[model samples]
Target: MNRAAHLLLFAALALPLAACSKVTADNYSRLKPGMAYEDVRGILGKPDKCSDLLAARSCTWGDDKSYISVTFVGDQAVLFQSENIR
Candidate 1:
């Protein structure tokens, strides 16, 4: 093959591998709504900061990579939202 043909073939082969490390929605897909706070913590690891409101049965977890604020009532998550910061 000519030089130009070889370069094109190589670029086409490398494109798929180049995008393999991207983070997608699937990474956090297993975290279903209504899961316990502990389970969510286990899946996402420790948060950068967390606070508890005694009157409200909920916790706000602020992570460097994502914000996961979950409401819990008797060990059950009633509300949850996860978003990427980076």
Candidate 2:
């Protein structure tokens, strides 16, 4: 491959990695009781897992380093927790 094509390929591969956002305390601070599910998704992107129940739903976002879990009643967030994964 030519130099320009190699550079283009490198950039194309790196762009997606740059766009990935990690869950952080700042993201957790954005959550509030009664916040809508769509609103939470807006701030945190998408959860790694989600569980739907009869009257509530829960979503978890995490990696090997940290995690945040939010529980929603109806469409609004009612409880949430965050912790470092050791």
TM-score on alpha carbons, each prediction = 0.47, 0.76
Which parts of model 1 are misplaced by more than 4 Å?
1-24, 55-66
lDDT of 1 by residue, 1-86 (tens): 99999999999999998655323345356567678777867765554455566634655444446555567766777776667823
Tell me the RMSD of model 2 versus the true structure: 3.4
Steric clash pairs (candidate 2) = none
User: lDDT per model, in order?
Assistant: 0.62, 0.88
Tell me the tens digit of each residue's lDDT in model 2 across 19-85. Answer: 6665778888889999999999998888999999998999998864678899999999999998873
Candidate 2 lDDT score relative to the true structure:
0.88
- Can you give the lDDT of residue 48 in candidate 2? 91
